[model samples]
Target: MEMNELKAITEGLLFASGDEGITVKQLARVLDVQGHTVEHLLEELKYDYDNTGRGMLLMQSHEVFHLTTKPEHSPYLKKLLETPQSTKMSQAALETLAIIAYQQPITRTEIEDIRGVKSDRPVQTLIARSLIEEVGRKEGAGRPILFATTKDFLTYFGLTSLEELPPLPDDINTDDLEEEADLFFDTFSEQIDQSNHR
Candidate 1:
Protein backbone atom coordinates (compact mmCIF):
# COMPACT_ATOMS: atom_id res chain seq x y z
CA MET A 1 0.00 0.00 0.00
CA GLU A 2 1.05 3.61 -0.44
CA MET A 3 2.59 5.43 2.52
CA ASN A 4 -0.43 7.72 2.90
CA GLU A 5 -2.84 4.77 2.85
CA LEU A 6 -0.69 2.91 5.38
CA LYS A 7 -0.70 5.94 7.64
CA ALA A 8 -4.48 6.26 7.43
CA ILE A 9 -5.02 2.57 8.21
CA THR A 10 -2.60 2.82 11.12
CA GLU A 11 -4.59 5.70 12.56
CA GLY A 12 -7.91 3.88 12.12
CA LEU A 13 -6.51 0.70 13.69
CA LEU A 14 -5.21 2.60 16.68
CA PHE A 15 -8.59 4.20 17.20
CA ALA A 16 -10.45 0.90 16.82
CA SER A 17 -8.09 -0.80 19.24
CA GLY A 18 -9.33 1.51 21.97
CA ASP A 19 -7.57 1.38 25.37
CA GLU A 20 -5.78 -1.88 24.49
CA GLY A 21 -3.62 -0.08 21.93
CA ILE A 22 -1.72 -1.98 19.23
CA THR A 23 1.82 -3.29 19.00
CA VAL A 24 4.22 -2.59 16.14
CA LYS A 25 4.21 -6.27 15.19
CA GLN A 26 0.40 -6.30 15.06
CA LEU A 27 0.37 -3.21 12.85
CA ALA A 28 3.02 -4.73 10.60
CA ARG A 29 1.08 -7.96 10.23
CA VAL A 30 -2.16 -6.17 9.49
CA LEU A 31 -0.66 -3.55 7.20
CA ASP A 32 1.67 -6.06 5.48
CA VAL A 33 4.54 -3.69 6.23
CA GLN A 34 7.85 -4.06 7.96
CA GLY A 35 8.40 -3.11 11.59
CA HIS A 36 10.65 -0.22 10.59
CA THR A 37 8.03 1.00 8.13
CA VAL A 38 5.37 0.84 10.83
CA GLU A 39 7.65 2.74 13.16
CA HIS A 40 8.34 5.36 10.50
CA LEU A 41 4.65 5.74 9.75
CA LEU A 42 3.86 6.10 13.45
CA GLU A 43 6.60 8.65 13.85
CA GLU A 44 5.28 10.59 10.88
CA LEU A 45 1.73 10.39 12.28
CA LYS A 46 2.87 11.47 15.73
CA TYR A 47 4.75 14.36 14.22
CA ASP A 48 1.67 15.40 12.27
CA TYR A 49 -0.41 15.33 15.42
CA ASP A 50 2.17 17.30 17.35
CA ASN A 51 2.75 19.97 14.73
CA THR A 52 -0.89 20.37 13.84
CA GLY A 53 -2.10 20.97 17.42
CA ARG A 54 -4.47 18.04 17.09
CA GLY A 55 -6.85 17.08 19.88
CA MET A 56 -5.31 13.60 20.04
CA LEU A 57 -1.78 12.26 20.27
CA LEU A 58 -0.15 8.97 19.38
CA MET A 59 1.04 7.57 22.68
CA GLN A 60 3.05 4.41 23.26
CA SER A 61 3.97 2.42 26.30
CA HIS A 62 5.21 -1.17 26.62
CA GLU A 63 5.52 -1.39 22.85
CA VAL A 64 1.80 -0.71 22.36
CA PHE A 65 0.55 2.57 20.88
CA HIS A 66 -2.90 4.12 21.11
CA LEU A 67 -4.57 7.45 20.37
CA THR A 68 -5.22 9.60 23.40
CA THR A 69 -6.64 13.02 23.97
CA LYS A 70 -4.10 15.69 24.94
CA PRO A 71 -3.65 16.18 28.66
CA GLU A 72 -4.17 19.92 28.28
CA HIS A 73 -7.65 19.20 27.02
CA SER A 74 -8.64 17.30 30.18
CA PRO A 75 -10.82 20.06 31.58
CA TYR A 76 -12.98 20.06 28.49
CA LEU A 77 -13.04 16.27 28.29
CA LYS A 78 -13.97 16.09 31.95
CA LYS A 79 -16.74 18.58 31.36
CA LEU A 80 -18.11 16.25 28.71
CA LEU A 81 -17.91 13.28 31.05
CA GLU A 82 -19.44 15.25 33.92
CA THR A 83 -22.50 16.35 32.01
CA PRO A 84 -23.52 13.13 30.22
CA GLN A 85 -27.15 13.69 31.12
CA SER A 86 -27.15 16.67 28.77
CA THR A 87 -26.95 14.18 25.91
CA LYS A 88 -29.51 11.59 26.69
CA MET A 89 -28.71 8.00 25.89
CA SER A 90 -30.16 6.86 22.60
CA GLN A 91 -32.31 3.73 22.49
CA ALA A 92 -29.30 1.81 21.26
CA ALA A 93 -27.20 3.08 24.12
CA LEU A 94 -29.96 2.42 26.63
CA GLU A 95 -30.43 -1.05 25.23
CA THR A 96 -26.70 -1.73 25.36
CA LEU A 97 -26.50 -0.40 28.90
CA ALA A 98 -29.44 -2.52 29.91
CA ILE A 99 -27.77 -5.58 28.42
CA ILE A 100 -24.53 -4.84 30.26
CA ALA A 101 -26.37 -4.13 33.49
CA TYR A 102 -28.26 -7.40 33.38
CA GLN A 103 -25.42 -9.43 31.91
CA GLN A 104 -22.44 -8.01 33.69
CA PRO A 105 -18.98 -8.96 32.43
CA ILE A 106 -20.09 -9.55 28.85
CA THR A 107 -18.04 -8.95 25.76
CA ARG A 108 -18.87 -6.50 22.96
CA THR A 109 -19.41 -9.36 20.51
CA GLU A 110 -21.96 -10.91 22.82
CA ILE A 111 -23.64 -7.55 23.25
CA GLU A 112 -23.67 -7.06 19.49
CA ASP A 113 -25.08 -10.53 19.01
CA ILE A 114 -27.91 -9.70 21.35
CA ARG A 115 -28.48 -6.31 19.82
CA GLY A 116 -28.16 -7.71 16.26
CA VAL A 117 -25.91 -4.82 15.32
CA LYS A 118 -22.55 -3.28 16.18
CA SER A 119 -22.17 -1.98 19.72
CA ASP A 120 -18.91 -0.05 19.46
CA ARG A 121 -20.37 3.45 19.66
CA PRO A 122 -22.76 2.56 22.46
CA VAL A 123 -20.02 0.85 24.44
CA GLN A 124 -17.74 3.82 23.91
CA THR A 125 -20.53 6.14 24.94
CA LEU A 126 -21.10 4.15 28.15
CA ILE A 127 -17.40 4.00 29.02
CA ALA A 128 -16.94 7.72 28.50
CA ARG A 129 -19.81 8.44 30.84
CA SER A 130 -18.31 6.13 33.49
CA LEU A 131 -21.38 3.95 33.31
CA ILE A 132 -19.49 0.81 32.32
CA GLU A 133 -15.92 -0.46 32.33
CA GLU A 134 -13.71 -3.40 31.54
CA VAL A 135 -13.77 -5.67 34.52
CA GLY A 136 -11.49 -8.24 32.92
CA ARG A 137 -10.87 -10.24 29.76
CA LYS A 138 -12.80 -13.34 28.85
CA GLU A 139 -10.51 -16.35 28.50
CA GLY A 140 -10.63 -17.62 24.93
CA ALA A 141 -9.83 -16.65 21.38
CA GLY A 142 -8.73 -12.99 21.29
CA ARG A 143 -9.64 -12.70 24.98
CA PRO A 144 -12.23 -10.01 24.52
CA ILE A 145 -12.61 -7.43 27.27
CA LEU A 146 -15.49 -8.07 29.67
CA PHE A 147 -17.70 -5.10 30.54
CA ALA A 148 -19.84 -4.44 33.61
CA THR A 149 -21.79 -1.53 34.99
CA THR A 150 -20.06 0.83 37.42
CA LYS A 151 -20.93 2.51 40.70
CA ASP A 152 -21.63 5.73 38.86
CA PHE A 153 -24.19 3.82 36.85
CA LEU A 154 -25.86 2.67 40.00
CA THR A 155 -25.87 6.20 41.37
CA TYR A 156 -27.13 7.68 38.14
CA PHE A 157 -30.01 5.23 37.95
CA GLY A 158 -30.71 5.26 41.70
CA LEU A 159 -30.22 1.56 41.95
CA THR A 160 -28.97 -0.11 45.11
CA SER A 161 -27.59 -3.06 43.17
CA LEU A 162 -27.99 -5.18 40.08
CA GLU A 163 -30.91 -6.83 41.77
CA GLU A 164 -32.65 -3.48 41.87
CA LEU A 165 -33.04 -3.46 38.10
CA PRO A 166 -36.63 -4.31 37.33
CA PRO A 167 -37.36 -7.47 35.44
CA LEU A 168 -37.59 -7.21 31.64
CA PRO A 169 -41.11 -6.88 30.43
CA ASP A 170 -42.54 -10.02 28.92
CA ASP A 171 -43.55 -7.97 25.93
CA ILE A 172 -40.21 -6.21 25.56
CA ASN A 173 -39.28 -5.39 21.99
CA THR A 174 -35.65 -5.11 20.94
CA ASP A 175 -36.93 -3.14 17.93
CA ASP A 176 -38.22 -0.39 20.17
CA LEU A 177 -34.81 -0.18 21.84
CA GLU A 178 -33.15 0.19 18.45
CA GLU A 179 -31.53 3.63 18.41
CA GLU A 180 -27.93 4.83 18.08
CA ALA A 181 -26.14 5.51 21.32
CA ASP A 182 -25.18 9.19 21.07
CA LEU A 183 -23.02 10.66 23.83
CA PHE A 184 -19.52 11.37 25.23
CA PHE A 185 -16.67 9.31 23.76
CA ASP A 186 -18.36 8.83 20.39
CA THR A 187 -18.46 12.61 20.09
CA PHE A 188 -14.94 12.80 21.46
CA SER A 189 -13.70 10.39 18.79
CA GLU A 190 -15.47 12.35 16.06
CA GLN A 191 -14.00 15.64 17.28
CA ILE A 192 -10.53 14.16 17.37
CA ASP A 193 -10.98 12.86 13.83
CA GLN A 194 -12.05 16.36 12.75
CA SER A 195 -9.19 18.13 14.55
CA ASN A 196 -6.62 15.85 12.94
CA HIS A 197 -7.50 17.31 9.53
CA ARG A 198 -7.74 20.95 10.68
Candidate 2:
Protein backbone atom coordinates (compact mmCIF):
# COMPACT_ATOMS: atom_id res chain seq x y z
CA MET A 1 0.00 0.00 0.00
CA GLU A 2 1.04 3.60 -0.57
CA MET A 3 2.56 5.58 2.32
CA ASN A 4 -0.46 7.88 2.48
CA GLU A 5 -2.81 4.87 2.64
CA LEU A 6 -0.72 3.33 5.40
CA LYS A 7 -0.78 6.58 7.34
CA ALA A 8 -4.56 6.75 7.11
CA ILE A 9 -4.90 3.17 8.29
CA THR A 10 -2.56 3.86 11.20
CA GLU A 11 -4.63 6.87 12.22
CA GLY A 12 -7.78 4.73 12.32
CA LEU A 13 -6.05 2.07 14.41
CA LEU A 14 -4.77 4.64 16.89
CA PHE A 15 -8.21 6.19 17.32
CA ALA A 16 -9.81 2.78 17.79
CA SER A 17 -7.21 1.81 20.41
CA GLY A 18 -8.29 4.66 22.74
CA ASP A 19 -6.24 4.91 25.95
CA GLU A 20 -4.53 1.58 25.26
CA GLY A 21 -2.82 3.17 22.23
CA ILE A 22 -0.81 1.19 19.67
CA THR A 23 2.85 0.19 19.68
CA VAL A 24 5.14 0.46 16.67
CA LYS A 25 5.47 -3.32 16.59
CA GLN A 26 1.70 -3.71 16.63
CA LEU A 27 1.29 -1.19 13.81
CA ALA A 28 4.03 -2.82 11.73
CA ARG A 29 2.44 -6.26 12.17
CA VAL A 30 -0.95 -4.95 11.12
CA LEU A 31 0.44 -3.01 8.15
CA ASP A 32 2.85 -5.81 7.13
CA VAL A 33 5.83 -3.47 7.19
CA GLN A 34 9.15 -3.21 9.01
CA GLY A 35 9.09 -1.71 12.53
CA HIS A 36 11.34 1.18 11.44
CA THR A 37 8.93 1.91 8.57
CA VAL A 38 6.03 2.13 11.01
CA GLU A 39 8.08 4.47 13.19
CA HIS A 40 8.75 6.72 10.21
CA LEU A 41 5.05 6.81 9.28
CA LEU A 42 4.14 7.72 12.87
CA GLU A 43 6.71 10.52 12.88
CA GLU A 44 5.30 11.84 9.61
CA LEU A 45 1.79 11.72 11.00
CA LYS A 46 2.85 13.47 14.23
CA TYR A 47 4.59 16.23 12.25
CA ASP A 48 1.49 16.72 10.09
CA TYR A 49 -0.73 17.05 13.16
CA ASP A 50 1.67 19.54 14.74
CA ASN A 51 1.81 21.76 11.65
CA THR A 52 -1.75 21.52 10.31
CA GLY A 53 -3.47 23.63 13.04
CA ARG A 54 -5.65 20.64 13.80
CA GLY A 55 -7.63 20.48 17.05
CA MET A 56 -6.31 16.95 17.65
CA LEU A 57 -2.77 15.69 18.29
CA LEU A 58 -0.94 12.41 17.98
CA MET A 59 0.64 11.67 21.36
CA GLN A 60 3.25 9.10 22.29
CA SER A 61 3.34 7.67 25.80
CA HIS A 62 5.37 4.64 26.83
CA GLU A 63 6.17 4.08 23.14
CA VAL A 64 2.45 3.76 22.38
CA PHE A 65 0.66 6.21 20.08
CA HIS A 66 -2.87 7.56 20.57
CA LEU A 67 -4.93 10.45 19.23
CA THR A 68 -5.99 13.11 21.73
CA THR A 69 -7.13 16.71 21.70
CA LYS A 70 -4.48 19.38 21.97
CA PRO A 71 -4.09 20.92 25.43
CA GLU A 72 -5.08 24.36 24.11
CA HIS A 73 -8.56 22.96 23.41
CA SER A 74 -9.16 22.00 27.05
CA PRO A 75 -11.44 24.96 27.79
CA TYR A 76 -13.86 23.88 25.09
CA LEU A 77 -13.67 20.29 26.27
CA LYS A 78 -14.45 21.47 29.81
CA LYS A 79 -17.47 23.35 28.51
CA LEU A 80 -18.74 20.23 26.80
CA LEU A 81 -18.27 18.22 29.99
CA GLU A 82 -20.13 20.82 32.07
CA THR A 83 -23.29 20.38 30.09
CA PRO A 84 -26.05 18.88 32.23
CA GLN A 85 -26.82 16.13 29.78
CA SER A 86 -23.23 14.92 29.99
CA THR A 87 -22.81 15.31 33.76
CA LYS A 88 -25.73 13.21 34.87
CA MET A 89 -25.05 9.99 36.78
CA SER A 90 -27.68 7.84 38.43
CA GLN A 91 -27.35 6.76 42.07
CA ALA A 92 -26.75 3.14 41.15
CA ALA A 93 -23.99 4.13 38.76
CA LEU A 94 -22.41 6.34 41.40
CA GLU A 95 -22.48 3.53 43.91
CA THR A 96 -20.85 1.16 41.47
CA LEU A 97 -18.22 3.75 40.66
CA ALA A 98 -17.34 4.22 44.32
CA ILE A 99 -16.99 0.50 44.82
CA ILE A 100 -14.78 0.17 41.75
CA ALA A 101 -12.62 3.12 42.78
CA TYR A 102 -12.04 1.80 46.27
CA GLN A 103 -11.48 -1.78 45.25
CA GLN A 104 -10.25 -1.65 41.71
CA PRO A 105 -9.31 -4.75 39.77
CA ILE A 106 -12.41 -6.11 41.44
CA THR A 107 -14.77 -8.54 39.74
CA ARG A 108 -18.51 -8.14 39.22
CA THR A 109 -19.20 -10.96 41.63
CA GLU A 110 -17.22 -9.16 44.32
CA ILE A 111 -19.16 -5.93 43.75
CA GLU A 112 -22.44 -7.82 43.96
CA ASP A 113 -21.26 -9.55 47.09
CA ILE A 114 -20.69 -6.20 48.76
CA ARG A 115 -23.91 -4.59 47.54
CA GLY A 116 -26.04 -7.68 48.07
CA VAL A 117 -27.78 -6.99 44.76
CA LYS A 118 -27.30 -7.56 41.05
CA SER A 119 -24.89 -4.99 39.53
CA ASP A 120 -24.88 -5.77 35.83
CA ARG A 121 -26.74 -2.61 34.82
CA PRO A 122 -24.64 -0.31 37.01
CA VAL A 123 -21.43 -1.90 35.71
CA GLN A 124 -22.59 -1.37 32.12
CA THR A 125 -23.37 2.26 32.88
CA LEU A 126 -19.87 2.88 34.29
CA ILE A 127 -18.30 1.29 31.19
CA ALA A 128 -20.49 3.41 28.92
CA ARG A 129 -19.39 6.59 30.71
CA SER A 130 -15.70 5.66 30.21
CA LEU A 131 -15.11 6.04 33.96
CA ILE A 132 -14.27 2.37 34.43
CA GLU A 133 -13.04 -0.44 32.21
CA GLU A 134 -12.07 -4.07 32.11
CA VAL A 135 -8.53 -4.01 33.48
CA GLY A 136 -8.06 -7.77 33.53
CA ARG A 137 -9.58 -11.10 34.53
CA LYS A 138 -9.43 -12.65 37.98
CA GLU A 139 -7.57 -15.90 38.51
CA GLY A 140 -10.22 -18.33 39.69
CA ALA A 141 -12.60 -20.99 38.55
CA GLY A 142 -14.58 -18.79 36.16
CA ARG A 143 -11.86 -16.16 35.61
CA PRO A 144 -14.35 -13.36 36.03
CA ILE A 145 -13.59 -9.99 34.43
CA LEU A 146 -12.02 -7.32 36.67
CA PHE A 147 -12.85 -3.62 36.51
CA ALA A 148 -10.76 -0.53 37.29
CA THR A 149 -11.06 3.22 37.09
CA THR A 150 -9.64 5.00 34.05
CA LYS A 151 -7.67 8.19 33.49
CA ASP A 152 -10.97 9.82 32.61
CA PHE A 153 -12.11 9.06 36.13
CA LEU A 154 -9.15 10.90 37.57
CA THR A 155 -9.77 13.87 35.30
CA TYR A 156 -13.44 13.90 36.18
CA PHE A 157 -12.59 13.88 39.86
CA GLY A 158 -9.80 16.45 39.54
CA LEU A 159 -7.37 13.91 40.93
CA THR A 160 -3.82 13.73 39.62
CA SER A 161 -3.55 10.02 40.40
CA LEU A 162 -5.06 7.14 42.32
CA GLU A 163 -2.78 8.07 45.20
CA GLU A 164 -4.75 11.25 45.58
CA LEU A 165 -7.89 9.36 46.49
CA PRO A 166 -8.95 9.79 50.13
CA PRO A 167 -8.18 6.76 52.22
CA LEU A 168 -11.10 4.60 53.26
CA PRO A 169 -11.84 4.44 56.95
CA ASP A 170 -10.43 1.48 58.77
CA ASP A 171 -12.47 -0.79 61.09
CA ILE A 172 -15.65 0.22 59.33
CA ASN A 173 -18.83 -1.74 59.81
CA THR A 174 -20.24 -3.63 56.85
CA ASP A 175 -23.60 -1.88 57.22
CA ASP A 176 -22.00 1.49 56.49
CA LEU A 177 -20.62 0.48 53.08
CA GLU A 178 -23.57 1.99 51.21
CA GLU A 179 -23.23 5.25 53.08
CA GLU A 180 -19.52 5.22 52.34
CA ALA A 181 -20.29 4.91 48.66
CA ASP A 182 -22.49 7.98 48.86
CA LEU A 183 -19.68 9.86 50.57
CA PHE A 184 -17.27 8.88 47.83
CA PHE A 185 -19.67 10.09 45.15
CA ASP A 186 -20.18 13.39 46.94
CA THR A 187 -16.43 13.94 47.24
CA PHE A 188 -15.83 13.15 43.60
CA SER A 189 -18.67 15.37 42.45
CA GLU A 190 -17.40 18.24 44.58
CA GLN A 191 -13.97 17.98 43.01
CA ILE A 192 -15.46 17.81 39.53
CA ASP A 193 -17.49 20.93 40.18
CA GLN A 194 -14.39 22.75 41.35
CA SER A 195 -12.49 21.62 38.27
CA ASN A 196 -15.25 22.81 35.95
CA HIS A 197 -15.14 26.31 37.42
CA ARG A 198 -11.40 26.62 36.82
Candidate 3:
Protein backbone atom coordinates (compact mmCIF):
# COMPACT_ATOMS: atom_id res chain seq x y z
CA MET A 1 0.00 0.00 0.00
CA GLU A 2 1.03 3.61 -0.54
CA MET A 3 2.46 5.55 2.39
CA ASN A 4 -0.57 7.84 2.41
CA GLU A 5 -2.91 4.85 2.47
CA LEU A 6 -0.89 3.24 5.22
CA LYS A 7 -1.05 6.39 7.31
CA ALA A 8 -4.81 6.58 6.92
CA ILE A 9 -5.21 2.93 7.88
CA THR A 10 -3.02 3.43 10.94
CA GLU A 11 -5.06 6.43 12.00
CA GLY A 12 -8.26 4.37 11.74
CA LEU A 13 -6.74 1.56 13.77
CA LEU A 14 -5.63 3.97 16.46
CA PHE A 15 -9.11 5.43 16.70
CA ALA A 16 -10.66 1.97 16.91
CA SER A 17 -8.32 0.95 19.73
CA GLY A 18 -9.62 3.75 21.99
CA ASP A 19 -7.46 4.41 25.07
CA GLU A 20 -5.89 0.93 25.05
CA GLY A 21 -3.73 1.94 22.06
CA ILE A 22 -1.77 -0.18 19.59
CA THR A 23 1.88 -0.98 20.08
CA VAL A 24 4.58 -0.45 17.46
CA LYS A 25 5.15 -4.18 17.17
CA GLN A 26 1.43 -4.79 16.69
CA LEU A 27 1.24 -2.15 13.99
CA ALA A 28 4.34 -3.45 12.24
CA ARG A 29 2.94 -6.95 12.17
CA VAL A 30 -0.51 -5.85 11.04
CA LEU A 31 0.85 -3.63 8.28
CA ASP A 32 3.44 -6.21 7.21
CA VAL A 33 6.17 -3.55 7.47
CA GLN A 34 9.46 -3.18 9.35
CA GLY A 35 9.38 -1.73 12.85
CA HIS A 36 11.35 1.31 11.69
CA THR A 37 8.84 1.87 8.88
CA VAL A 38 5.97 1.86 11.39
CA GLU A 39 7.88 4.35 13.54
CA HIS A 40 8.34 6.63 10.52
CA LEU A 41 4.64 6.43 9.72
CA LEU A 42 3.75 7.23 13.34
CA GLU A 43 6.07 10.26 13.27
CA GLU A 44 4.47 11.43 10.03
CA LEU A 45 1.01 11.00 11.53
CA LYS A 46 2.06 12.91 14.67
CA TYR A 47 3.42 15.68 12.46
CA ASP A 48 0.15 15.89 10.57
CA TYR A 49 -1.78 16.29 13.82
CA ASP A 50 0.65 18.96 15.09
CA ASN A 51 0.80 20.90 11.84
CA THR A 52 -2.93 20.77 11.21
CA GLY A 53 -3.79 22.04 14.69
CA ARG A 54 -6.43 19.38 15.16
CA GLY A 55 -8.35 19.08 18.44
CA MET A 56 -7.09 15.47 18.66
CA LEU A 57 -3.46 14.39 18.84
CA LEU A 58 -1.59 11.12 18.66
CA MET A 59 -0.05 10.07 21.97
CA GLN A 60 2.38 7.26 22.56
CA SER A 61 2.58 6.14 26.17
CA HIS A 62 4.72 3.10 27.02
CA GLU A 63 5.18 2.37 23.33
CA VAL A 64 1.41 2.21 22.72
CA PHE A 65 -0.02 4.72 20.27
CA HIS A 66 -3.51 6.20 20.74
CA LEU A 67 -5.51 9.24 19.76
CA THR A 68 -6.36 11.66 22.53
CA THR A 69 -7.68 15.18 22.80
CA LYS A 70 -5.14 17.95 23.14
CA PRO A 71 -4.67 19.49 26.59
CA GLU A 72 -5.73 22.90 25.30
CA HIS A 73 -9.27 21.56 24.96
CA SER A 74 -9.52 20.41 28.58
CA PRO A 75 -11.64 23.32 29.70
CA TYR A 76 -14.34 22.49 27.17
CA LEU A 77 -13.98 18.83 27.96
CA LYS A 78 -14.41 19.61 31.66
CA LYS A 79 -17.50 21.63 30.92
CA LEU A 80 -19.06 18.76 29.04
CA LEU A 81 -18.10 16.30 31.73
CA GLU A 82 -19.42 18.48 34.53
CA THR A 83 -22.73 19.41 33.01
CA PRO A 84 -25.73 19.14 35.35
CA GLN A 85 -26.84 15.78 34.03
CA SER A 86 -23.49 14.09 34.49
CA THR A 87 -22.19 15.95 37.53
CA LYS A 88 -24.68 14.52 39.99
CA MET A 89 -23.10 11.34 41.28
CA SER A 90 -25.47 9.64 43.72
CA GLN A 91 -24.43 8.82 47.26
CA ALA A 92 -24.29 5.14 46.40
CA ALA A 93 -22.15 5.85 43.39
CA LEU A 94 -19.85 7.98 45.49
CA GLU A 95 -19.57 5.23 48.06
CA THR A 96 -18.86 2.73 45.35
CA LEU A 97 -16.23 5.02 43.87
CA ALA A 98 -14.58 5.42 47.26
CA ILE A 99 -14.39 1.67 47.68
CA ILE A 100 -12.99 1.17 44.18
CA ALA A 101 -10.47 3.93 44.69
CA TYR A 102 -9.21 2.56 47.97
CA GLN A 103 -9.65 -1.19 47.62
CA GLN A 104 -8.88 -1.85 43.96
CA PRO A 105 -8.57 -4.16 42.28
CA ILE A 106 -11.56 -5.38 44.27
CA THR A 107 -14.40 -7.61 43.19
CA ARG A 108 -18.13 -6.93 43.48
CA THR A 109 -18.47 -9.58 46.19
CA GLU A 110 -15.75 -7.89 48.21
CA ILE A 111 -17.45 -4.52 47.88
CA GLU A 112 -20.79 -6.01 48.95
CA ASP A 113 -19.13 -7.65 51.90
CA ILE A 114 -17.77 -4.31 53.08
CA ARG A 115 -20.89 -2.31 52.36
CA GLY A 116 -23.21 -4.98 53.72
CA VAL A 117 -25.52 -4.52 50.74
CA LYS A 118 -25.86 -5.59 47.15
CA SER A 119 -23.98 -3.08 44.97
CA ASP A 120 -25.06 -3.96 41.48
CA ARG A 121 -26.89 -0.69 40.75
CA PRO A 122 -24.17 1.55 42.17
CA VAL A 123 -21.50 -0.43 40.35
CA GLN A 124 -23.43 -0.04 37.12
CA THR A 125 -23.73 3.68 37.69
CA LEU A 126 -19.98 4.05 38.26
CA ILE A 127 -19.29 2.02 35.15
CA ALA A 128 -21.73 4.11 33.11
CA ARG A 129 -20.03 7.28 34.28
CA SER A 130 -16.61 5.89 33.41
CA LEU A 131 -15.43 6.45 36.97
CA ILE A 132 -14.52 2.78 37.42
CA GLU A 133 -13.76 0.02 34.93
CA GLU A 134 -13.26 -3.70 34.85
CA VAL A 135 -9.54 -4.03 35.30
CA GLY A 136 -9.48 -7.82 35.32
CA ARG A 137 -11.21 -10.94 36.61
CA LYS A 138 -10.64 -12.78 39.84
CA GLU A 139 -9.28 -16.34 39.92
CA GLY A 140 -12.12 -18.00 41.82
CA ALA A 141 -15.12 -20.17 41.04
CA GLY A 142 -16.96 -17.53 39.00
CA ARG A 143 -13.93 -15.51 38.04
CA PRO A 144 -15.75 -12.41 39.21
CA ILE A 145 -14.93 -9.09 37.58
CA LEU A 146 -12.30 -6.99 39.34
CA PHE A 147 -13.00 -3.28 39.48
CA ALA A 148 -10.64 -0.32 39.49
CA THR A 149 -10.69 3.41 38.92
CA THR A 150 -9.96 4.85 35.49
CA LYS A 151 -7.92 7.88 34.42
CA ASP A 152 -11.19 9.81 34.29
CA PHE A 153 -11.52 9.16 38.02
CA LEU A 154 -8.26 10.97 38.67
CA THR A 155 -9.28 13.85 36.38
CA TYR A 156 -12.73 14.16 37.98
CA PHE A 157 -11.22 14.40 41.45
CA GLY A 158 -8.36 16.70 40.32
CA LEU A 159 -5.84 14.12 41.42
CA THR A 160 -2.61 13.70 39.48
CA SER A 161 -2.12 10.25 40.96
CA LEU A 162 -3.58 7.87 43.52
CA GLU A 163 -0.68 8.49 45.90
CA GLU A 164 -1.96 12.03 46.38
CA LEU A 165 -5.00 10.71 48.22
CA PRO A 166 -5.11 11.53 51.91
CA PRO A 167 -3.68 8.85 54.12
CA LEU A 168 -6.19 6.95 56.16
CA PRO A 169 -6.34 7.77 59.86
CA ASP A 170 -4.09 5.45 61.82
CA ASP A 171 -6.69 5.06 64.54
CA ILE A 172 -9.47 4.17 62.15
CA ASN A 173 -10.80 0.69 62.59
CA THR A 174 -11.02 -1.50 59.50
CA ASP A 175 -14.34 -2.95 60.74
CA ASP A 176 -16.06 0.36 59.98
CA LEU A 177 -15.74 0.16 56.22
CA GLU A 178 -18.61 2.57 55.61
CA GLU A 179 -16.99 5.23 57.76
CA GLU A 180 -13.73 4.71 55.94
CA ALA A 181 -15.48 5.24 52.62
CA ASP A 182 -17.12 8.39 53.97
CA LEU A 183 -13.79 9.78 55.10
CA PHE A 184 -12.28 9.05 51.72
CA PHE A 185 -15.09 10.85 49.91
CA ASP A 186 -14.75 13.85 52.20
CA THR A 187 -11.03 14.03 51.59
CA PHE A 188 -11.51 13.63 47.84
CA SER A 189 -14.07 16.44 47.77
CA GLU A 190 -11.74 18.76 49.67
CA GLN A 191 -8.90 18.03 47.29
CA ILE A 192 -11.15 18.71 44.31
CA ASP A 193 -12.20 22.02 45.81
CA GLN A 194 -8.59 22.99 46.42
CA SER A 195 -7.61 22.07 42.89
CA ASN A 196 -10.44 24.14 41.39
CA HIS A 197 -9.24 27.21 43.25
CA ARG A 198 -5.77 26.96 41.79
For each candidate in turn, the TM-score is 0.70, 0.53, 0.52
Best-fitting candidate, measured by lDDT? 3
lDDT digits (tens) for residues 66-184 of candidate 2? 89889998788778756778667766777778889988889887787766667876886677668999987777554467899999999887689999897766865767656666666
Q: Quick one: ranking by lDDT, best first? A: 3, 2, 1
Candidate 2 Cα deviation (angstroms), residue 15: 0.5
Per-residue lDDT of candidate 3, residues 1-198 (tens digit): 899999999999898765456888889989999999999999999999999978889997656788988999978977876686865666667777887898899988788777777787788678767889988777855456789999998987768998976677789778887777677667566654564455
Q: What is the C-alpha local distance difference test score of candidate 2?
A: 0.79
Clashing pairs in 2: none
Q: TM-score of the candidate numbered 2? A: 0.53
What digit string (tens of lDDT, one per residue) describes model 1 on residues 1-198? 689999999999999987667889999999998999999999999999999978999998657798989999989987886783636666567778877877688998888777778788889888987989999888876567799999998877656887877555465554543332222223233433443345
What's the number of clashes in each of the models? Answer: 1, 0, 0
Name the better of 1 and 3 by TM-score.
1
**Stronger candidate by lDDT (1 vs 3):** 3
